[model samples]
Target: MLLVRPPGVYRAQEDTSLLRQVLRRRGRRGLVEGRSVLDIGSGTGALGIEAFRAGAADLTAIDLSRRSVLTSWLNSRLHGIPATVRRGDLFSPVNPHRFDLVLANPPYVPTADRPPSRHRMARCWDAGPDGRVLLDRICAGAPSALDEDGTLLVVQSGIAGEQATLDRCEEAGLVAETVARARIPFGPVLRARVPELRTRGLLGPDQVEEELVVIEARHG
Candidate 1:
């Protein structure tokens, strides 16, 4: 299998365990077959590329990282599929159009209390220090970008204030559920997350929880 890599200040590990769980639960219910799809923050285009394999005919992938856009284009070439990968801020380059499926995996690291240099995509990773910044934006903007009955899938950390994100989605007119959850070991970024969580009282001063909660949501 060709390795799938997302480029940026920080590249995601070469794994799709969480995404697979999403497919297992919501894939059949979503517009996977012969539908138009948009991937926001489409790092390396994993989810969108899978949508194509599942039968989505049109795909538009957007990411703020230029390296990510280039890598996505390369990955699409390797997959023998045509995808439009653009480098732009969220929804800036996209017109207000409805899509059968809209997917995103935003950076959900809260850094309000932590040092900034620890994260590469400081803007992407720091979501208002509670990690809900980008997630909230996506939830709020997704309904307008989705077609009637369109579904939006997003993955975030349990520590990223997952419940708050669900609530934000609901406020934005979408119903969300915890479709999947996984424990990802502390990576380079974990060093920073540990202290932040400790300060926030989410974890004991000496205890560090090494896991993230992933959720999938659908628009009504």
Candidate 2:
């Protein structure tokens, strides 16, 4: 997909690709055909574009970054697909509107003391302390934003507590499980925080890689 990412917008990476792959597979099985789709924390709008290509009847992309909103809008136009791109916190811009599918690749990277910044690039991956800030919020709120029989797919690093996410989803009345996983080398951020993570017991002493897991939750 051709996309224009400004300085502060997140570049499409492994997590993004993982979600897209799942979408493609589900699309082929006709799960996404003509369904209403919502892409939260939309960075470059890649997932929204994929949802569009998957024959989503209605599409919406939301991001906290203004640059991301512009980039997403441009990308949707470039792809000749109709999508509502809005600059706001996750789910805020599209409240009272539920969808058949909700996709999220929220900030799950663990940061020491600082919370994620809404106006900065670090907001793309900085989750507070245990990295549950956005993930937990999404888990708690997603169920309310999904239509009956809707599905929500979220990608997060294992270090951020995969089981915690599942537990949260299940608490929200959804059946959740890890649908896909990929082991990849730690990125610069994680590499820099290895010591802190190790001290916090989130990572093993000799761990050098991180596992990305896609959690799929469905309304029961």
TM-score for all models, in order of appearance: 0.85, 0.97
Tell me the tens digit of each residue's lDDT in model 1 across 66-147.
Answer: 7778877788778987998888877778867678888787877667645434336565566666767678888888888888
Model 1: CA > 4 A from native: 4-10, 14-16, 24-31, 113-124, 204-207
lDDT, candidates in the order shown: 0.72, 0.91
TM-score of decoy 2: 0.97
The sequence of per-residue lDDT tens digits that candidate 2 reaches over residues 1-220 is 7888888889999999999999999999999999999999888899989988988898999988888889989998898988988988788888989999999999988887576676667888889999999999999999889999899999999999999999999999999999899999999989899898999999999999999999999987
Give the range where candidate 1 is weakest over 10 consecutive residues by summed lDDT: 7-16
Candidate 2: list runs displaced more than 4 Å.
Answer: none
Highest TM-score model number: 2
